[model samples]
Target: MKVTHNTAAGTFTLTGKMWSNTYPLDQLDAWLAFYRRQRDEHPKSGNSYDKGIAGLGRCRHSSRPRPADQLALRAEGQAGACVRVLGRWAEAVSRGKG
Candidate 1:
């Protein structure tokens, strides 16, 4: 997955295999804020929180997971990459490097 923050457009675009989504900066900010609060409130449920933030979960609708879901599961721990990318973007913007 590749995430790019377009400052001029005020959006974050996430591109993945055969799928892509563009989200408003404020939307991402709200999600991150909510997740951070959830983590602080329930420290022991960090994994669940991360998965929630990453939009990752089990395939409950079928007996076998789809190929895409399997790929996501394999990329489990890498979910935080998106968050890290956002953080770096924020830092760069803050430092007048935008």
Candidate 2:
């Protein structure tokens, strides 16, 4: 995936493929954040936290599942505002009326 962080616009972008096609840039950004956190903690690469990208379980929908859908539970672990920030960034970046 490709990411571009435009501080001036306060936006973050995550780009990649989903279900054989580009899964909207906004979706990509959300997935990317989750992947990064997951990737770093996983025991291995390519297989680390790569199981919950499509809203699947096993990952429990946490915010740092590497590849899980962390749109809701990414906060209970770290500081208490990570999830909000992530969602905000995603939503802010997802703006622009695409």
Candidate 3:
């Protein structure tokens, strides 16, 4: 799977049979978190994490953030956390846990 961050567009584009979803920055954390948790709890489960990510991608798109952008700014930290979690999950999966 290939996931690219288009800074110009502020979007994440994931492409592959297993990961074909365009995820907005706003909802990236939730998607990463749900998949990470499932992977952590069931490392050996085949494709659960993949399925979770895909399922999240299929969910209705999140509405744009409200004009009060303070809350969204505060949640910027979550974006980093999500990246870390996704990294670990990917490493584990690559090592054959899944």
State TM-scores per candidate: 0.32, 0.26, 0.39
lDDT of 2 at 64: 25
lDDT of 1 at 88: 54
Candidate number with greatest TM-score: 3
Clashes of each: 0, 3, 0
Question: 1 or 3: which has the higher lDDT?
Answer: 3
Clashing pairs in 2: 35-66, 38-66, 63-74
- Per-residue alpha-carbon lDDT of model 3 for 1-98, expressed as tens digits? 44445322346665677657787766666766777788778879877467547544543233222222432443345776445444544555677752
Among all candidates shown, the one with the greatest lDDT: 3
Worst 10 residues of 2 by lDDT: 58-67
Regions of model 2 farther than 4 Å from truth:
19-36, 47-98
Q: Write candidate 2's Cα lDDT for 1-98 as tens digits.
A: 43443222233444455522224333544655667678777756765345444332222222222212443344445443555546555664567421
Q: Tens digits of per-residue lDDT for model 1 on 1-98?
A: 44555433456665667898788765665655676688789988756566544541121121122244443443335766434444555666677763
